[model samples]
Target chain A: MKRIIEVKNLYFGYEKNLVLEDVNLDIFEKDFLLIIGPNGGGKTTLLKLILGILKPWKGEINFYDDNISKKIGYVPQFSSFNKNFPISVFNMVLMGTIDSKNFIKKYKKEEIEKTKEILDKLDLYYIKDENINSLSGGLLQRVLIARSLVADPKVLLLDEPTASIDITSQLNLRDFLLELNKKITIVVVTHDPTSFAQIYDHIACVNRRLFYHGRGELDAQLLEKVYGCPVELLGHGIPHTLLKEHI
Target chain B: MLEVLSYKFMQNALMAAFLASIVCGIIGPFIVTRRLVFISGGISHISFGGLGIAYWLGINPLYGATAFSLAAATWIGFSKQDKMSESDLIIGILWAFGMAIGIIFIHLTPGYAPNLMTFLFGNILTVPRFDIFIISILVLVITLSVLIFYKGFVSVALDEEYSKARKLPVRSLNIGLLILIALSIVTLIQVVGIILVIALLTIPVAVAKEFSIHFKKIILISILFGISICLLGLFISYYIEFPSGASIVIIGSILLGVVKGVKKILKMKLNLDETIN
Candidate 1:
């Protein structure tokens, strides 16, 4: 696999508080990477740094792709923006087609066609004209995904995609992501690993520091170190006993 | 009402209302959707300080207001952070601080005091033709900008971070929109004044959202609603001798309440019919 992005000695903070420190990671093309951490463990901040939304206080993020802007897509947290905003499903997805070059110009025919294609693929075509405010949590989440997919990004970064959806929606999203991983790279920041169990090729536990584990079994000490407690992992096709009883 | 249109001042007032409505209609939804109502209020109040300074300097109060509001808008935009409560506190302080400054400066002015009530309560009948000319220019500029950058503005308004990820110059777009909002507030001040400017900026959009889900349609509807409200309020104030700004806001509030109530009743009737089946 070819490396696509490199994070070397990254340090970031807000005001006086340090959020992420001395972090390093390598993301390859077509890699399915899951970044797991406890609440407020800088998961979302890390994603923001990679997406160039936040500047790192002391480190460099190197992107190998010359056209990084067009090659990377981001799906922010479901609760990041107000869902009560008066916008339709079709228009919301269509906004994904805008970029630095074409923002002042009108939408082209191909861009609208691409948006429709993505909506169809996500099974959201029927409700294309529906107001986003009237959609359920799961459907809204799917809309966010569909919006990102319309950009045709080589590397897709999602922050807590399964944070608030139902179990069925979570499973469906997981399967959809798995199918997408076949064609492009995916980096997901999620605290809940159970939903994406036994699928990610690489797992990076983050808590100020990062512990990267490649394919195979994960060490219980690594989970304990990142989470500051013994975590129980329950899923098929994985180790039955994840950690010692929390005593 | 027909006889009133024959007066030159009444014609000017009507022209100002129509122009101001176009601006409010275009800018209001962005303010409402982005939840910037409070920030817009802060800018409006801060402009009062400019008005006071202009009174002291014997300059156009509208010019002073434009400069102050644009400054405040830029400051607020750049100072915005991820923590909303912190930003809210800053805006709240500026809002009060601005009013205090305006009052103090107006007190220090060394001439017969300008009628402060006109600036506070607004008299649309007294709107000069020059101010109408200014508002017309504002309406044209706002319309053209929205026409070209509608999608970009919508993207930033909907999700700032996502827009940034797409390399949409999120910071510049945000600052640009804030600047336009400042200009809108300053221009509308003639029709509604500082005390009631935010209501003029937001109320029409609130009512229009009830009629449409599409963003552009809502904007179009809001413009029409704004024009009608301004005209109605002007006529009501004429007959009752009430303050024009307050009358406009009062009419807008009642309209909103009536629309919401009717929608609720219709929804309940539909549910009842479904149960009967």
Candidate 2:
């Protein structure tokens, strides 16, 4: 497989506090990589660094042999989007296809037809014209995922893709992502292990540094090492215990 | 009504209200949805310094106000490195500094400035034919641009990070939005004045929001609401000898209250029905 992203000794910080330290990783084309860790483990920070939203204080991130400043599709945490924002589902997804380099270029007919096909695959064609504010959380998540997919990115980064939804929606999103992983290199920052159990080919645990990189089912010992505690996995695909106590 | 139309000044004021409200209507929803009311308010107030400088320099105050406000808008748009609160503080400082500069410019300008009150309180009644023509063309341009770039604007306003990730030129679009807002503020200053400009920008959109679920519909309704309030305010001022800007703001406030009250009552009734059913 072709190498899509290469991160070398990545160092980043917000003001005085250092967030990421000497991180090195290589993401191959169409790799389903899950980044899991405790809260404030700099998972989102790393994702931002890879997406070129924030420049690293040290080290470098390269996409397709180029500097990471090149654009990549990003599915941000649901909390970041204002629910009251007046936008339709179709328009939201259409945004993914917009070329920043050519601002004045209009969407071609072929692109619209392709977007419809993606929306249909996501089972979101019915809500194409629906107000985004009125959609259910599950529907909105699918729309966001579709939005990212429409960009046809070389690498797709999702920050906690299933953080605040119910069990069924979480499972549905997991299945959807698994299907998506077949096409693009997927980097998802998640806290829930079960949500990524069947989908992820490798797990990258981050706590200001890369702690582990391995294949197959997640090992509790490795998670404990990264989290610095005897963590317990709980029901409904969530991390219930951190440091042997409920958290 | 016929007599009102007979006067050219009245005709110009009416045309200005129509054109300005159209601009406000189209752009207002974006501002309200993005929760950039404070920023817009800051820009409008700061433009006073530009207006004052123009008066001091014996030039067209509109040109100075537009230039100063556009500069402030650009600064606000590009200063993303700072936290939101810190950025807001910067905008606030500019706002006050702009006003101070305007006041000093007025002080520096020689002779009695009889028409200065017109800029401060809005002289819609004395709007020149050329000013009316300029406002109409600007409103047309603004409306057309919004239509052409509706999707880009919606995405950026809704979620800028996602927009950028999708390679949507988020920064440039943001700057475009700010520039449009600066132009709107400069144009509307003649209709409602700077003091009540924010009120005009926010109130119609706020009221329309309660009634419409879609952005496009909200904009259309906001234009209707804005035009209605302006005309109502004009009539009230004509009849009761009240200040035009104050009267328009009062009309907008009343409409906002009515919309909020009606929405609350309808929501309560729906809840009651659900409980009984």
Candidate 3:
């Protein structure tokens, strides 16, 4: 498979405290990559480095032979936008056409139809006219996905897709992501162990360092090393295919 | 009310009030939605330094203020892009620096300071034809830019990171907004007075947000309702001998109070309906 992103000898941190050190990773096209780690383990930082939002302190991130930024779709975990802001779901999804060539141009008929299609696929078509603030967490997350995916980006990056949603919604999201992975490359940073058994193409364990990167059937010992704790059992809610308890 | 129009300055003031409400209507939602009230306050005061420079140079104070405010706005935008927390501190420092420059220049200017209260608290009734022309031009420019870039403004204000991911020129759009903000602040100085500009920028839109969930509707209601208050304040000041600028603000406060009361009633009604259901 051709590589879409390459990070070499990366080092990053906040002012005084170092977060990531000598990290390197390669992301291939059409690959579904899941990054899992304990809390405060620099998962988000590594993702930001990959997304080119935050600059790495020492190393470089290359995007398919170009240093100029690539158009990577993003679903942010914490938007900090006031939910009471006056935007309907349709308008919110219509914002996905930000990449339209004509800057400040009106949304085209095809763009509007495309937004509707994405919303329908996410099972959120019924609430297209409703206020965004009134949307439930599940619906909101799906709308966010629709917003990012409307651009038809080659790479889609989601930061904590299941952070605030309930277990049932998270499971439904897993089903949705599995379906979405058929088209574009997907990179996700999640702390939820319950989402571990979603059968990603590659699972990279991050803890201030790229400790393990391989298939989903990662042994219990490697999981323990990445988590810096004992993983004698797979998570209580995780699917049975996730672990064999070889710790 | 027809008799009041006999006076030319009263006509100018009313026109200024009308033009200003429109500009505020269009720009107000962006400021409030993005939580830039403090930054607006900072920009307006920073432009006062330009007024001081104009006074010293014997030039039109409005021109000086516009130039100064834009400079301050660009500086603030660059600083904010560099470091967000550090920018907050810089805003405070810039706020004082601009005002201090203005005050020192005013002291240095030869002759009486004239009625400085008009610049500080705004006596809209005394607006001249030149000021009205400036206000009209600003409203036109603001209206045109908003019409052309409505979606860009909405996306950038609502979620800049998302906008960035979509490959929107988030930085340029942000800087453009700050420029509009700078012009809005300069144009509004004569109506709301530099001291009360934030309330002028915010209160009407804040009231409108309660009644509508669409940007266009909010902007429309803000303009229409703000004009109603402007005329009402003019009449009240004419009859009761209250100051004009202060009166308009007072009416806004009363309306805000009424809006809160209505919100409470609506909430109670919603709860009642839920209980019955």
* Candidate maximizing DockQ: 1
What TM-score would you give candidate 2 relative to the actual structure? 0.87
How do the residues A1-247 of candidate 3 rate in per-residue lDDT, one tens digit apiece?
8887888999999887899988888888888888777888898888877765677899988888342245578888855455757888888888887763655788788898999898888888889888888878888888888888787778888889889888798888887777777877888888864474535777666778875445646665555544533242233224423433322
- The prediction achieving the highest TM-score against the true structure is 1
**DockQ for the candidate 3 complex?**
0.47
Query: Which ranges in model 3 have alpha carbons more than 4 Å from their true place?
Result: A15-18, A64-71, A79-84, A216-247
Q: Report the Cα lDDT for residue B173, model 1.
A: 81
Residue clash pairs of candidate 3: none
Q: In model 2 chain A, where is the ten-residue run with the lowest total lDDT?
A: A238-247
Best to worst by DockQ, what's the order? Answer: 1, 3, 2
Query: TM-score for every candidate vs. truth?
Result: 0.92, 0.87, 0.90
Model 1, runs deviating above 4 Å = A218-231, A234-247, B82-84, B110-114
> Taking the tens digit of each residue's C-alpha lDDT, what string does model 2 give over A47-141?
87777667899999776755334436788998888777866788778767775654456778877887998899999999899888787778888
TM-score of chain A of 1: 0.88
Q: On DockQ, who's better, 1 or 2?
A: 1
User: Candidate 2, which CAPRI tier?
Assistant: acceptable
Winner on TM-score (1 vs 2): 1
Output the number of the lDDT-best candidate.
Answer: 1
